[model samples]
Every structure is written in C-alpha cells, then in structure tokens.
Target: MVASLVIGILFLVLGMALRYWINRRKFYRRSPIGAESFSSYEKSVGIKFIERVGKWIAYALIIFGLLSLWVYSREKNDNEKQTKAVESTR
Candidate 1:
C-alpha cells in the first residue's frame, strides 16, 4: 500500500510536470516572434517532437496512476474480506 501510494504520487507529479512542459511549449509557440523567428525546418521538427514526447509522457503517467489506484482498491477489498472472514470465524 505504501509502495502504491508512492508510485501514484510519482506518476501524478510526472503527469503534472509533463503538462507544464507542454503548456510552456505552447506559450512559446504562440508568442509573437516564436514561430516567426525560426528559419529552419529542423526547429519546427524539434518543437513538434517535444510536443509529441510530452503528450506521450503525460498519457503514460495518467495510465500509471490509474493502474496504481486500481491495485490499491483491490488490495483494500482483499483486506476487508480477510477481516470479515476472521470476525465470522471468531
């Protein structure tokens, strides 16, 4: 449970970070001189790459967090079942 909590927190943090990065990139891209100042195709490609990577990272983090939550719930349910069984046996 502790491990799952830690992992969930980590994933949440990572997702937030990725979202921040994506927003920062978007802000710069929309700036008055952002795209206008870039003369090379390579620069555009790099920006696109960054956006894509950030999106993937954010998605992965979300998935990870969800999976962790599922696992935690399952564990909690199992623990509850065990407690109920013990009480009935007593």
Candidate 2:
C-alpha cells in the first residue's frame, strides 16, 4: 500500500510536469514573431514539430496517470476485502 501510494504520487507529479511542459511549448510557439523571423514554411514546420511532441507527451502523461490510479484503486479494494474477511471470521 505504501509503495502504491508513492508510485501514484510520482505518476501524478510526472503528469503535471508533462502538462506544464506542453503548455510552455505552446506559449513559446504562439508568442509574437520578432523582426528577425523565419520564413512562413520554416515557421509552419517548427509549429508542427512542437505540436506533435506536445501531443505525445500529453498522451504519455495521461496513460501514466490512469495506470497509477488503477493500481491504487485495486490495492484499496484488496485491502477492503481482506478487512471484511477478517471481520467475518471474527
């Protein structure tokens, strides 16, 4: 149970970090263009790359968070069952 709690916390933190990174990347991409700017094609490509990377990171974080929640829930259910069984025997 303790281990599961730790792992769940880690996953939550990791998901938050990934979310922050994706937001930061998007903010950078959307910021105004300076006097020295890349061509339209180059800018488009950069934006596309950032979008793709951000999507992948977001997906990974979501999956990790879900898995952690699943594990925690399962552990809790198991503990509850054990307690009930012990009480019944008593």
Candidate 3:
C-alpha cells in the first residue's frame, strides 16, 4: 500500500511537471510583434512533435498515478478490515 502510494505521488509529480512545461511553452510562443503574427507563425516539426508526444505522456502518467492511488486505497481498506476482524475476535 505504501509503495503504491509513493509511486502514485511520484507519477503525479512527473505528470504535473510535464503539464507545466507544455503550458509554459505555449505561453512563450506568442509573437512579440502582435497577436496576428502568433496565429500566422507555423509550428516547426520539433515543436509539433513535442506538443503531441508530451501531451500523451502526461496523460499516461496521470492515469497511472490515479490507478496506483486507487489500488493503494483498496489495499489499505482491506488491511484495516482484516485487523479489525482479528481484534474483535480477541
């Protein structure tokens, strides 16, 4: 349970970092000349690649984190139930 929780937290943090990077890149992509130029500028192959792949990676990380947390919660509850049953029997 603890291991799962730790893994979940780590994945979540990594996902968050990637998300921040994506957003930061977008924010900085604006044209200094004018808003019109921002839309006119075409994305390079590398930037486009990162934008596409990074989004999927971030999504995967977040999903894995959530799944890990869910598993941790389920195990924790099961352990608690077993301990309670043992104590009651005594």
Candidate 4:
C-alpha cells in the first residue's frame, strides 16, 4: 500500500515534470533562433515518444495505487479468515 502510493506520487511528479518541460520548450520555441534540437521539437506534440510513454506510466502507477488498496483489503480479509479457522480448530 505504502509502496504503491509512493510510486504513484513519484509518477505524478514525473508527469508534472513533463508538463514543465513542455511549457519550457514552448517558451524557448517562441523564436526560430532558439537551439532546441530537431528530435526534441518533433516530440513537442508527443508524436514521437517519451511524453506519451510518461503519460501511460503515470496512469499505470495511479491505477496500481488503487489496486494496492484493494489488494490490502483482500489480504486482510483472507488473514482474518485463516486466523478464525485456526482458532476454531484449536
């Protein structure tokens, strides 16, 4: 649970970073004289890669965080059942 939340936060931060990078890139692209690389410019719209992948990763992490909570609940329930069964047997 904790791990997933941490991972989700980390992914969220990365997505935020991508947002910052995109805004900064746009800022720098205001003039043709800027030194932004060709490949970098090509990815401005997330057409090439990187940004899109980051988005997917962020989504996956968020989903994983939610799943982790469900997992914890199921695990707790199973544990309780096992304990009860053991107590009854004894």
> Would you list the clashing residue pairs of candidate 1?
none
Best-performing candidate as measured by TM-score? 3
TM for every model, in the order presented, reads 0.80, 0.63, 0.84, 0.46
Q: What lDDT score is found at residue 72 in candidate 3?
A: 98
RMSD of each: 2.3, 3.8, 3.1, 6.2
Candidate 3 residue-wise lDDT, 1-90, digit = tens: 799999999998899899999977877776776332233235465676778899899989999999999999999999999999999999
**1-90: candidate 4 lDDT, tens digit per residue:** 456455656655665666667566556655667644455655655543665575566566556655665666776788899999999999
Q: Please list all clashing residue pairs in model 3, or write none if there are none.
A: none
Q: In angstroms, how far off is 63's CA in candidate 3?
A: 0.5
Residue-wise lDDT of candidate 1 within 52-90, one digit each (tens)?
888988989978987887788888899999999999999
40: Cα error in model 1, Å: 2.7
Scored by lDDT, model 4 comes in at 0.63
Off by over 4 Å in 1: 32-39
Of 1 and 4, which scores higher on lDDT? Answer: 1
The parts of candidate 4 lying over 4 Å away from their true place are: 1-43, 46-49
Candidate 2 total steric clashes: 0
Better of 2 and 4 by TM-score: 2
lDDT of 2 at 64: 73
